[model samples]
Target: MRGGGSKNSPLETLGENANLEISGDLISSSTTEKIFEVSTNLGNKIRLAHSSTSNGKVLKEHGYIYNVDAITGLKSITVAFEGELKLTTWYDDILNGQSVNLINNETSKLSGSDCAWFRIEALKETKIDSIKIEYTCDAKDGSFAYTSFDDLGNLDREGAKNKNVTVSLGERNFEQFEYAYDGVEANKYNQKAFVLGNTKLNKYNASVPNVGEYKFTFLNGIIKGGADVKNPDNTNNSHVFMLLPNHSDVVFENVIFDSTVSFHNEFYTNTWAYLNSLTFKNCTFNGGIFDFPAKELTITDCTFNKYINDNGQNDSNPIWVRSGAGQKGEVSLNKVTFTNNTVNAYRPVKFERLGINNNHFELTFLDNTFNMSTFNDTDLKNYGIYLDSGVTYHSFTLIDDGNVINGGNGDKVYAFNGVVDGNFPTKMGTKILDRNGNEKVIVGGKWKSIEEAKLCSSIDEVATDTNINVSSSGTAIDAIKSSFTGDNATKQSTTISLPSGNFSLKDETDRPSLKDKTVVFIGSGVNSTTYLANKSATGTEKGSDYSFDGAKLVVFKDMKISLGTANYNGFVRPQNLVFDNCLIEGMGHYWGDKTTFNNCKFSLSGADYNIYLYSGVDFTFKNCEFNSPTNRFMNAYREETSTEPIKVNITNCKFIGAEDTASAPNAKPVVNIKKYINPIWQITIKNSSLEGALNKEKGFYQAEEGSKGFVSIDGNVVWEAE
Candidate 1:
């Protein structure tokens, strides 16, 4: 009764008087297509599984119904009816065929009807074109609760389920609804066959066409897994879900799918799985796993929550969300939110793609909020956004962003890329919370790009009084090519406007050599920067590498620099430098030998770093501030492989914060001088005040384990020491 009637005479079910006829009022026909009606008590469920090409149109009176919101006057529904509905294709019976006017004759609103309902009339042959489940819902309340279909064929229906409805139509009327049955084949209903929870589902071809105003929710418990053991050999590309739609802009929001239900494989796939030219808005994530094993995907206007469910220990960032394979794609998040649940949730998002390749992926966070419990936590000192360890992104953008660190931690964000765009606040007050209660912590300074960071100034701005201004007596060429580094340039008397931030002589394009140039910095508000120097265009100016003497550049008052790096490698020496009311980054290598800093604050919050230093001349610091989770001043190798000696001088400095047990240093500072075979000679620390936050074994000086060094603190108040 399901398929064709008897193989011998396939037309035996058709009587001699069984000719199909379609009138304006009714449909009359004699055929052997079985019919049935199905209904379910559940609110969100499936109904029929059949092999009838001419399924009937569900009548309004007989359809499984849902209650409506009284105020809205519309049904508050989340019903997915997956039964066969006959289309108005060709009419056939004992005779050849008959034409039918399937169009609704009651009203002349044909265009609106075609646009609203799921109706298709014209067809050549009868085939099951689609096994569709039409889901109707109102997001106003908890009207629809469906979960766990991303894990193919495995549906955990312990949550909310929908009711089902099915009906069969006469062959004559079936021809009227032929458009709804194009190229469809009757097969067993794979109720939840295309879901894979938090795991990956590769090579799925589910067609979604013209899906405007329809929201598809993929939510369920995902299975927890780790990196794949045989990633390279695994043939199936693991994915969380695969959305293959044609000419559809569907809304996918409020969906939760994790690895609790599926098998977790570390090297298996990417987080958020894969996408193809789709727009997702207002989605929330509750996991710390990341993956990038698919071709392409795009996400916009979403919230990612990564707080742990337990205590103070840092949770593992088990999620890997990125794009892999030769599938170029972009994922944009407008106003994306990422919040940690516990103190130890360090890195939330990590991109693994690196260098130049055809398979490119872009992740953007615009006007977003990233909240953390504290910024002072010693164990959780990492950026909210991070790239792959060795990966250098082509371009990354973090614009108009705000972050809150109620506890002790490090930077709010970090990146290694060609271009990074963000508002790098320079002043103490400028980086404060606004009227709306948004905090913009000026951790150090932000530059638009590596080129901008190199130039340090704008196109027309000249380094005068330690501030950027138009070169009144200099030359001006094209508007775009009017930087200070340009040679043989025409001077312009006209002044040009520039964006405001910290400006120093090091940011100038061409200011002679550090040994000869005595660049003066006297700006009111000069923040921190990595390093500023024009690229060695001809290889003769400053050689084809980083070469600067920090001793020669005399920095004046109103300046602050924290931890920063200027060179790609550790081959060049830090130029001669001096600081007055400036905070130099103390975390990195203090490459300058003849360097002097005065009346400046050097804390780990601003100018802290982990770089090594090689001093060869007088290294003096007086009337300065030194407070960091790590040591405020030091000198060492890039790694512990080099045994070079670090020589320096300290005088009349105020050490407020120290490297205590609570705030431990990321790397062991080379405070132990005995470890260095070369040994530091003529070291002096005189007339400096030390108090509030000092390690027991690390005061005036703590040599590396077994290094030879000397420490002296004279004429200063000492609070505590090891």
Candidate 2:
């Protein structure tokens, strides 16, 4: 999608050259003969194969040689390069190629005048016959970087076995030799479609928003590394698609993630910890996934499928819970689809508690389907809904018909009330009807109530049955906040009793105290106007680009935001905050901090760029829609300094940019790349749709002319017109 020309005449934008035009299908390079003979005096004696003794003179330039075997009449070779490499061969090598009978660990010696080589035996047989290798020279810093023909999706040859490749850069290491075979003729042996490294995005003039009604409805675009934009919104703004916070609350609705959503390991310590609220509505998470870790989480009307991995086995359950070191919160799934991928193993969900505070579990698998064959007998030992806390108010609702709870490892399902067992045919398969033929509260699925199984159990007996409380909080807490500085707050974590009714941040004076905050919204449903400023507040610049490294805030929402006033600027400034179904748009001032937006829409205006980004922040967008500006989208840019840049990310989203925008002059069409020295913009865009006109249009020309830097676009659709 980054190159020029049609599929037949793609621009040969090789790593060796910044931009190169190619008319023919193949690009060739002449062989370089060694200046020195077999003498060891040339540089250092380099080992040819895996032999301990150095067999050939090591040339200063890093490369390799291919030789044919003399005995077996086979050609085999291996290469080690100083930088990135590109390898390709004729179509015949892969398609209808002859399969070789090379055994595992077998080696073939080369036979040429002073040419020493050995056939690197593959673990499995392959039909590959020919190969072309293109590599770059390493820099002086001992870091080897390379981009290959494989990245271009031009391998064209299906290998019987995967290639063994290794890359070393200073203390960093990369070892990828084999990839899964897609089974498709064009994609066989190429397990991974592409690899992104430290990419970035920069834009200008983000849209703004309105007031009261909160709205955030623009899907994020992921570029490798980071994305830095200069957004000055007119209203409050938050994130809308991330398992991790990206400077604002996230809203995940109608999106898909084929891979795992992780926090930027280079910048943040706790990845999935900061979340106000997370909601999954009409989305799909195929691989093992994680939402804002250690936060109030929820899922409704979504599909969570743990598809089988390449090994013909499933990864862990679809959801892996490492809830922020045991903070009290809830994880609810309603009208969701939990399908077991035929290609993988079972156990749809797993939870591990490691935090200090005990969690108040509220899990619901409503109207969901858990394919039976996925889970094995032993899976239930550590699978399904779990309450790691020894004592907590938890609920598990299986609302689907034919929902089978495999009775394995003697594990029984219990409702939050602790008496209503969550299984089929309650009361030991007895028909104990209530006032209207509904089942009785206490089924045989949970620990029994004492009192000799009497017909009329006393209140004291019911209380002592499971030693758990059953009373619900009559009223919802309007505001809750925890703000603890240093050690005192950490030591004195806030705790709210179970069944606390709907928590809401009603007005400017009413903010859930984040001071020493450990507030958990465990009630059935809660609503909060997250990141939205009060109507009376006039002088207040929207909390744009605010950083939250130590603050912990968790919230839940039954409905989503409507894309009103919210901040959208700077690198993730919030330490931990999550939003669910909250509309966040570019309306308020700029306050881009570390935050997560799950199941929210972003469709508003009032910022130079829809979202702005700065340094030291990591964010993610999951299943959110992104409708970019029709003209141009740019982030903050300084013409002089470049030390502290900006970054952001978007995944499993739908992006719609403006139509017929002109390309930025003398620069690529990326935001935050203009007016700076040594500027670095890291962003990654994957698995999304980028609808709208490309740079060839007039609108994009004006925008692209103003920026400079790297922009990596993969697995996205790019339209030529609006």
Candidate 3:
């Protein structure tokens, strides 16, 4: 009744004559080769009994059923015929998940990744070789791809005892699906078998992008788990989370996955445990990760925190990955970005792959930050890769597109690699970031640090001038040009700009107080970015001696501001300043403080750093052209005593490198960021490029701990060399 020895012929059992379960283990186990010739296109099926619970009692009316025990089951069902196969699965008692592999179907529009039920885990294998699968899905029971777990609001409410969410496809389905996790029987459904997401990517109206923060549909669901010995939370006091698959982008927003308690296998395996095309927005991870064998896993603006006094023994990471055996598949990181996420460790993501080598893992870390010194957390950090001794990743491409890393503990990483993976070289280490933040790898693994980065001194705060602003648009014009001759000084006027609206100038003393530098200036009755400038600058030389210094809010239009050498030795900072259409002629700019230069021209002939950065918050240069001559365009450093992170943005700006690579073979980077006393600089150089030669190796100096910074060279920002 079950197999095909004496009871029934294998050929007749696969036909319309026999409606009994065949023993695939019994049939494939023997070398006799009981080949059944049946037309798959004519709706033929080779049913198998459940591996557990019932020996698969539920059988289809007209198909050959085989025993589905993977331990003693048919390892593979090879169809020599090139045609469509409607792959359907049915729950057999408690056969957790069957992680099936459909090989030789590279062009197959197949389905089924890990599933809740054999019912939910169904696929139609459409082959390129004249095989077209039926584009239909038949759900049995709660076998549709969509699933949900719990509701939020209340604090400590655990859901139903049957907590597993499973769906499958078949003519027959289970009513009120009752499933249990018998941890006592460990390998029955191993602790590592927790499936967060296991279906092919689904289509929807609203989806998440690879980078940037998204307005996530918050599923305020929480789960209180049972006890486990390895968890920090065993007493059911915390609310944990496990992402349930919805066949598409389902954001687990604001939910917390408690690492206090081990949620099954926090470290992923190539089973139902892997996520496939899932998005997690604004979520928090205590244990961290649903990594390994992941397909298009997008995590945006999520906070990851993990700490264990395992006494430096556990190879745990916030997003950890390990596979003892070679996983022969593709695991692409469509977008594993962390723009606004806080990660604790120096290197939040740790991966150790010691396998036989058959994987293509291509990853690009763009526009995020890994601050703090984590290189000393483990022994592997000494090699700059933090890889275990026998680890071999031949096809691993870790691109430091733009990430800022602070420092390492053990030694200075000369050829800095991966802020995400200590193996990624010089995203921000040893070298300063490229104007656009791309780590153009030096040919050999050798690197030399830019010596100028160590020359930074702490910032000296200046006093705020209260009565420096002009009262009205017409009056502002008079105050600036009336005394603005060769000296670049105004008549007792510190900073002048048009008032926002219809300003009736009472007096210069009655202007708005810009002492706190908190107000945003906009053009009167025009776009916030555009102001009607009826007048142009009288001359193009001389950097302004009139400082926009202090945290004073000032906006300048059609003016020439100074980038002078004086007051740049950490004396004055160009804080809270905005320049539009300004001509900057001096050298050695200093102390960036929330400054934005738009449509500005930097005409300094030659100096050290065009922008001698000391300390401050941020700087942005857009639509600017620089014909400056210097060792490099910019270099920065922060003292060990400070904690404020520096951020610089140079976008849509063109720079002429001081030396050509061919002419001066030892040419260096244009933008130089320094090695710091911890807190990093979030630097983004996008839509910008250089016209001359630069060292192929040097890009940006590396950057931190809890707080993350944004580092990326996005939107075609490559340096040109001839």
Candidate 4:
């Protein structure tokens, strides 16, 4: 006989030498339910006998009796009580197809008893059907071990929809929970729906498959590093969710996430595949990064705290879409409403679309409160939206509305080193409302209300001046070039104000024509208006006469001219011209007669010379600085045989060498004069500072053997090459 007893067992000992025990295996028939009774005394053991039949004729073998035995010999057994008997068993045996109705509210006081709670192992090979479970256990406190549920178990078929199973876990707190249906096949006809509800899960990791819709509701979870079950070697312990290819929908509502989340590749080569849509509504994410690359992503009523690192390890800004060769698709952030959110990030969003053909990318920011206060790192201080460089795709658009970014450090909205001319936000200081009725303005290095700025004049009113303001509306260079020709040509004694912007002049036909015009071109400032020439004029006849024509008297003030690869002269043969507070950079030559300069600067790095005079004329320089690091200052090359020599006068002018320091011996000569048939060049330097010494013993000019020139240096300071 086999018998088991706890301290509260009802069986009693018969005598000092006789102990009572019982053992039985309950047997059942196909048609009827059987019942058994037990009756025992203090010193006697009871056991029931199996009967073959009631008569001699064998009772038609209806059902067999239950096998019963007793440690002490007994004749008959009878019931003494009327209440039902309850059984307690281990959960692990229940998972192995044990049939027992477990008591719902039983507590095991033992510390290491398997009958305390049930556990289901989510191994690679496990299958379970309809089960009801109710427990008040904590996985973190060692009450249960196998608490996580993973759907990647080895099933027989591709679709588990036929199983029709439901696991009702009631009011349990788990340390971690995982769900992944990666290998499931797509099923549009009878797609199944899995639901996990009423659980306060500490950690979560899920990847919805293509076959069905997965809904997670009322889940308060924290997903972070070291919470994942499949931790690959030599990788960060991060939580990743991939909406696999052909996935229908994954919804997360009424969930609070207190961990970092990423939606990118599983590894370097394993991308998240393709997803139709992913939606998040009414969620609070404490700190997380989103590297989502989906067809359509919708986020509404969410709060994001701290900075989010997008793709890689370095934390600068969150990259939304970086489309490359194999990652080309029509990705979009459709109808994202953060109306009840507070965002604190360095660079909030960075979108880059390259090598994507016939695909559109769109982003929309609506009704959100942004705090541009903190940064991912100290070096990444520009806390605003960062548009990646060279983001040229088929079509891209951005819709921003009702978003307030406060405490801005740098540009509130900045694009990288590329040209982005689509619907971009205006300058930060400008008062404007975005498309979604959001007031946005940057004030005192912070984003604030437009009314707080209290500007003295409106931007439109300040822009409408009486002077002829050059517009960079269309092709900037072409616009400026067109302004100098046709009926809109600059008139005499008129002020042509250049706008405060950069202009790219590429076409040769787009060069400004200032021939015979006596106009004064005023700029916003020396560093404000920049004219960048793109075409090269090397080895061309007009190389020395590029950008301008032989105007009579033109005045240029407060502007910057940048020469391209062309060895082009910025100004050519302006009879009587003046330059005031201008910066001429990368100019190959400057050929003009009777030219006067005041408070002007020149940066001629690899030029032939800073100034070249071919004819005998009066060129005066007062308070002008020339910075020619690698070339000569002045080159007087008179080819014609004339009795009149080129005359130049420099007063209070400073000539700086290419090498800024005094210890460099690479300084060039001050003046170089070529041999002429009738050499009579004259130069006067008084009250001026020359950084490098003159070329020859004549101090200011190096004339050929037969050439002659007069260089008068009076009260001038000369610096010898170190």
Best by lDDT: 4
Q: Please report, in order, the local distance difference test score of every candidate based on alpha carbons.
A: 0.32, 0.30, 0.36, 0.42
In model 2, what is the error at residue 627, expressed in angstroms?
2.6
For 1-722, candidate 2 gives per-residue lDDT tens digits of: 00001111111112122121111212333223211111222121111111111122221122222111111111333233222222211111113222233332233222222112222222222222222221112122321111121231222112101221111111111122222222335632221111322111001111211121121111111212111111111101111122122122223433454444432121121222233344443445555454233234555444555444342243444554544421232322111223321212254354433222422232333333343233443333322343233222222222222233443223222211122112221111122223343322222222222211101110100011011121453323321232233333343333232342322333334343344343333222223223332233332334332222234444322222222333333212334444443445543323323445443445545434444433334445544554556333434443335454344455455545655434222222323334344455545555445456652242221222434444445633332111
lDDT string, candidate 4, 1-722, tens digits: 01111111122212111111222321222222222223322222122222232232111132111222121221122211112212223322223322232222232222222333222222122111112222222222332222122432221122322221112121222234333333333511121112232111111223334434322222223333322211111113333433232333434433445544444432222233434455665555554444444455667665565554444333434324444322344433322223445566555554554325434344565666667654334544444454444443333344565566676554344334332111221111122335753332222111221111111000111111124567755344454544555676543334556778775433456466656655556666666777554344554436544444566665666667665434444555667667655676765344456676655677775555676665437777755678765536777665556566667777666777643334333434667766656656677877666664322222354555555667677744332211
Task: Compare the candidates by TM-score and give the number of the best one.
Answer: 4
- Per-residue lDDT tens digits for candidate 1, residues 377-496, read 444424454444223233222222343433223344443223222222121111122235332222321211222211010111123322234233322122113322255233221222
Could you estimate the TM-score for every candidate? 0.30, 0.29, 0.29, 0.32
Better of 1 and 3 by lDDT: 3
Each model's total of backbone clashes:
127, 183, 38, 6
Segments of candidate 1 deviating more than 4 angstroms: 1-216, 219-252, 257-274, 277-286, 292-315, 325-344, 352-363, 366-382, 387-392, 408-722
Order the numbered candidates by lDDT, best leading: 4, 3, 1, 2
Candidate 4 clashing pairs?
Answer: 14-43, 401-436, 402-438, 407-447, 408-446, 629-658
Candidate 4: C-alpha lDDT: 0.42
**Candidate 3: C-alpha lDDT:** 0.36
**Cα lDDT tens digits for candidate 3, 1-722:** 11111111121112222222233222222223222322323222222231111122222222222321111111223322232233333232223433343344332232222221221111332222211122222223322222222121111102211122222112111112111222233333322222332212211111222321111133322322322222222212221223322222334443455443332231222233323444555555555352333344455556555444242333334554444211234433322333444555534354454232434333334544444444344433311223332223433334444444445433332233221111221110122123364423311111122211110011111222222354544554344333343353322334334454332111233343323442222222122223322112222212222223453555544434444354233213445666554555555444436777765666664344556556567888766767644435566555533556677787777776644445444344656555555456667787666765453344533332232344678744242211
Candidate 3 lDDT score at position 124:
34
